[model samples]
Target: MRGFGDAAVEEVPDPVAGPGEAVVDVACVQPSVTECMLLAGEPIAMHTVLAARLAEGPVRFGGHEFAGVVRALGPGAPDGIRVGDRVTAVETAPCGRCAACRASHPHACPSPAVLGFTGPGAFAEQVLVPARTLVRVPDGVTAAQAAAIQPLAGALHGHAAAAVHPGDSVLIIGAGVMGVLHTQVARHGNAGLVMVSGRSEAKRELAGRAGADLVMDAVGDVEAAVLAATGGVGADVVFEAAGAGTFELAARCVRRGGTIVMVSVLPDHAGAPLARLRERGITVVHPRSGGGVFEHALRLVARGDVDVDCLISHRLAGVEALPEALAITRDKQRYGALGPAQVDLFDWDRAA
Candidate 1:
């Protein structure tokens, strides 16, 4: 993005791979809700860094959730990845020298290089990425599906954090992209009852299609409905994906000693029922990133276990449509979008 809330298609030199890096020809790229929020100058965690970059000049801002073919590899690139391979990458690359990495906890690394944020992203025709982050796209998974797998990986991570057990009741707030994905994941992961709450009728229906046993309007008494469904106990695990101002609802809907996974990119100091949560001994989990689940998520998509294609609502052609795609993703309800907006930059299937 050139500046906060500004994006355009402009000519720029093609990226060349540096040592330990690879250049991928982008086939499909999707704009995420988080990216749209960040671009619109939302004071999320990365706002300051983006502001600094804007002061310097126009930045190549987005396209982390993308799938493409490896075009070139530089010296010291990983051995297994080859040019022309269909691939998607984990956005976070931890510094191997950090204490977290030395302890085999790369996900906790304090210093990590984030694709599309720390460097130029895949919004253009080509993007440079660390070779180590590359994950091969399987045969059955389309470029669009691969481009959208990052969020599914995130959903998997959130589900794992909840430590769901068979026959447990699960509740998801916000039937947006993450909410539907979480619903599917929960249903497939052995949850006995899956409940979803959202403001949009269409999104609530989408959640039901994705395996939500019960769908409630967020504008209603969601807490009461959840309690009624759970036999006055409340959900065993709740995923709060509706951003700020919903933590209290999640707290109210979750059973005592249950888990609440904060899937949304919340503001620095979002209000919560802190005392209630503490008194109830609730385990609140904030899944940091979808670092290690890309391969598993891709496998699920390839095996038709997860339906990523059904969630895609808008597919615009060419990089020129990026601004429009971002707009739709930013205001999905206004645009009647069911999921993130995707832009196809190349005909990867035809080429293959």
Candidate 2:
């Protein structure tokens, strides 16, 4: 991004492997909706904090969800990491030399370089990532599918914090990729009743296919519908995957003593139903994105337990389409995009 709300493709130097890092020949990349919002200089927390630095320079941002073959490995890279390995990596890499790392509390690391947003990302033909974050893509998963697995890994991290158990009820707000993934994950956990709320009929239909027992139009009284579905009780767990605006609905739909897992990164000023949450003694949680969840997510995808292909609505070729793809993700409703628009940097079929 050149400045707030201005983005265009310009030729940038191709990334090269640095010590302890590797250069991935990006096969495919999918830009998250949040990335598009941030790139547009929305008043999201991330942009707000980085506004000054961004204003000082042209930044290469977005494309944390991607997969590719290892093109080059720098010296000191771990054993078993080699060129030609197909991999998808975790976006957030913790700084292991910090006080938090010394204390064995790596999650509290004060400074972590968020790939794409903080540094160069996978929006181009190659991206440099910490070798430690790489997760091998299984044989059967396509590059496009591997590119899309990062978000599923994030969903799995949230599900772990939700502490979902068999016979528990789940309500997911926003039938987007995370919502649908949560729906499928909840079902896999044998949740008694799984519900999803979406503003679009198409998304609702997709939610049903993802194993949501009930799909409610988000414009209507979602809390009432959730209550009705639970026989006067609210959902045992509510997933706020729809971003900041849906926090209130998540609060209202969750039963007293139930948990609310916030998967989306909301803005600093985003409204929350704190009073109601306090009154109900609701446990609100924001899950961190680690714990080997990517491995579990990969297994699920490889085993066909989660259906990612159906959520992909647009697939564009080459990095040149990134600008238009970002716009499509921004105007998702207009474009009928269920998830981030996938951009293929290299021909996966040809590689296969």
lDDT of each: 0.91, 0.87
TM-score of each: 0.97, 0.97
RMSD of each: 1.2, 1.4
Q: What's the CA RMSD of model 2 in angstroms?
A: 1.4
Alpha carbon deviation, residue 190, candidate 2 (Å): 3.9
Write candidate 2's Cα lDDT for 25-127 as tens digits.
8999988888888877778768765687676887887788999999999889888778888999988888999989889997898888788977888888989
lDDT of 1 by residue, 83-141 (tens): 99999999989988988999999888888888889888888899999999999998988
Best by lDDT: 1
Model 2 residue 85 CA deviation (Å) reads: 0.5
Candidate 2 overall Cα lDDT vs. reference? 0.87
Q: Give the TM-score of candidate 2.
A: 0.97
Show the lowest summed lDDT stretch of 10 residues, model 2.
47-56
